[model samples]
Target: MTFPVVGMVGGGQLARMTHEAGIPLGIRFKLLSDTPQDSAAQVVNEVVVGDYRDLDTLRAFARGCDVITFDHEHVPTEHLRALEADGIPVRPGPDALVHAQDKGVMRARLDAIGVPCPRHRIVADPADVAAFAAEGDGFPVVLKTVRGGYDGKGVWVVDSVEEAEAPFRAGVPVLAEEKVDFVRELAANVVRSPHGQAVAYPVVESQQVDGVCDTVIAPAPDLDESLALHAEEMALRIAKELDVVGHLAVELFQTRDGRVLVNELAMRPHNSGHWTMDGAVTSQFANHVRAVLDLPLGDPRPRAPWTVMVNVLGGDYPDMYSAYLHCMARDPQLKIHMYGKDVKPGRKVGHVNTYGDHLDDVLERARHAAGYLRGTITE
Candidate 1:
């Protein structure tokens, strides 16, 4: 039997982590990296150095692969279509990926599909933003660049027309939405296979700081069981509707009125599902590979009653080696996954996962370890 070689585009930590998952399954991962120093390139043995933006570069890199997938959503749709036309399998194909590529398109499709979502519109200018805001509570609207945004960038919670200028400066259509009075953020993660098989993981509560994910609590504490199942169903419906054949992370906003509204969608493995690396029966990285390859999926059930994942944002401390040693000595059970990235302030360099029957204990262990890695927690 010939093992299918999967070629992943992008050189970030996501690709690096996915390559790790492919190891045990005897899967060969080929990567197209922007630079030889890129995170995935450093570890993935088959590294093709090229820019994904150039059609020629992408064409050459995809030639020998059994299938191609992405570590990011930035690849141009036309290029993917070109590859698809040549009989190259592109998991979560370009048609479905476009929704994740552009916020406006995602919102429009979600509305059309009857998925619960926030009231949003594509506004031409800041004045148009105010016009939409007026239809609601007025002012303090959320503005986002229609495309090319992630990790807290390209998003603005504008309290006034002047505050909305930043997103407009991006020179892309701005998506204006009513500022949701959300109780907390949640993520419903699901994986779908090319054969139409699918599975949903437990809904997770995600906490953000300046729009970047900081911590995640799996099986969000005391979340209404019916609502939890509804979130999962919505995610599954979305995958089927969009023809998404890989991991889909639906970021949600649970409002003060207790309704779950779709906030964002990610076509690839997302930060919100990182808890699954150690907490679940199968990690998102592994499922993404299996899904893209049309293999039978692994289980999504959690290994424990509660799992807490806390991101280790880069701080002044660059000595992760020292921190890791200390954290390992302190909580031997803690599972820390480092990205092999250079430390930079506020960048997600790694994460720590801890699972236990007690929520507080699990959260503390994960948080303390992550904080220590960031050199924030002492004693």
Candidate 2:
């Protein structure tokens, strides 16, 4: 039987990239976005403009599609449950998606499952933070809102009681976690199908600036073979335990002592795995679509010895086209993917990926090309 259409809830860059993947599978991607200005709307044929919370809008957008999934984890669990009640197939259903939506719940669940995570608590008020810091062994813990936190927003580092008052007054519950002293951060991207088939990509090291990811290096240079296997095994274990279908991205921290700790979870295609687009035999976007549709998963083999991806943060760049030309002129192997959004300071406007031998050289070349794209470097 021929496959049916796939409906995506958010039309951000993830959906945009997924649309590119679905095209080759002969599967149509119909997106429900807020406006035509959304990143995916520019490239896809079926773009529905509406609010994600509106059932009428969702019902309209979901018409005739065999399966419904998300580019983001923001869709309310109630909304997804409602669709399931009406016989709509929701990949990585509400049960699994909830683990990504609420950090408090996720931490609690993972702790019960024996996953190693940072010391954390659900704080009702800022005073709880002060007491925790005073009573606990660690000071200056990380404060994160239980929900709606992303890209460094809704997160804070509090060293003293004075730093906790704002959240207390705002009536927002928070998760106070002991700050981890780690050597580096890494992410493992794993995908699963409804039939229990799973595949894991190479563990990638992420470079961060102010808690935002700036670049990713696949297979994490100089990483031990044992560590790579452990990362992949942990990711697969989480996926099976959570019964996660579609994609599950586990962000981990390698502590100073060389142990890996789970930091965060994402149930969609993630920024950390963008290098898979050009570096892997099958891109993550493609695998996610296949998983949601219950199609056979593809191999997650790397295309070359190394792959480096650098994020393009928006800055004061006048002629981005000229910068693009410069990158192509200097390094013809670089593949650039830019979201069609107006540039602003610190926003992720695009990314550039380079795949070849020599991990260090690939990373340096990618960073230099990205600097040009950001108008930060002349050559």
Candidate 3:
């Protein structure tokens, strides 16, 4: 009758939500947080304030955990290897996690597998960037830091060589890519177990504002059935190819010509799948725990015909709790999840999920609640 213990490195909101999912299953969730105030540290009973980059700290945290996973991918890869050498299980091992950690590696690997992606190159210097732009789409290219970039921080739309210098300041290799002429962005999420069992959730349409996710809608609007299936297949194929256990999120771009191109990869419960918490038959967090533990996965079916999730960004109004009464009174269907974090402008402090049989109604409900919480919408 011993319940398995799962240790998650990094104490962000993802770990917080994963802890909530583990509670019902009676599984133990341990946190290796950088600070006592980190999102999950405030709630989880077992919290270890340690730097994930330190191999000694990581080894100490994994002492009794059955499996080690992550809330973020910034951990030193060699530290993960050290844990594996100690006979501890690391779901989506360092080999698989590297592709998500380094954009350059991700692109090269995807290209080798013939996954549809925009043309890209690893530039040694700014001049190499210019050469890539000259040979490819020419000017207005996207430049990204090969490692350690998230949200909108490390991405740049460079129309000229001068515009690309900022990204190189981090001393990381720069990845130059053709700026995709996409009509919209999409995401396909899947989970795989160690036994090779996997499940793909319905494709979702993700909206971004300044490179940060703003909202997500399940079963993307106007998506052709064939194209949706293709995206799912591509995501599932990638999980198998990389031997990725736990969750895998494939960010994609839908071109004007109706083709879907791979955009990015996240080997954890992603913002795009946040709608699953209340909209699907089983939440992504629950399945992530099951997958990493090598248990049978829960069904990925949607409970409602349409589900829309809107991110609540921190704004001038710091006390979002005040708006809760109005949001719930107006729409009891709204499910609001507020992370335990300080309010900072443009920070993702929480999100709202709305589900129903009608798409437009659910979309409006989710958006309005999120907007109200951010103080962008009055009444």
Q: Highest lDDT among the candidates is held by which one?
A: 3
The candidate 2 region of ten consecutive residues with least summed lDDT is 164-173
The better-scoring model by TM-score among 2 and 3 is 3
Stretches > 4 Å off in candidate 1: none
Off by over 4 Å in 3: none
How many pairs in model 2 have backbone atoms within 3 A of each other, for residues 3 or more apart or on separate chains, i.e. clashes? 0
Over 201-308, each residue of candidate 3 has an lDDT whose tens digit, in order, gives: 999999999899998999898899999999999999999999999999999999999899999999999999999999998899999999999999999999999999
TM-score of every candidate? 0.99, 0.98, 0.99
- Candidate with better lDDT, 1 vs 3: 3
All candidates in order of lDDT, best leading: 3, 1, 2
Candidate 2 residue-wise lDDT, 15-86, digit = tens: 999999899998777899988999998998988889999887788777788899998999889889888887
Candidate 3 deviation (Cα RMSD): 0.8
lDDT of 1 by residue, 1-379 (tens): 5999999999999999999999998988999999999888999999999999999999998998999999999999999999998889999899999999999899999999999898899998888888999999998898888898787788888998888788877587889999899999999999999999999999999999988999999989999999999999999999999999999999999999999999999999999999999999999999999999999999999999999999999999998888878899999899999888999999888888999999999999998999999999877
Report every candidate's CA lDDT. 0.93, 0.90, 0.94
Clashing pairs in 1: none
For residue 348, give model 2's deviation from the true position in Å.
0.5
Q: What TM-score should be assigned to candidate 1? A: 0.99
Error of 1 at 210 (Å): 1.3
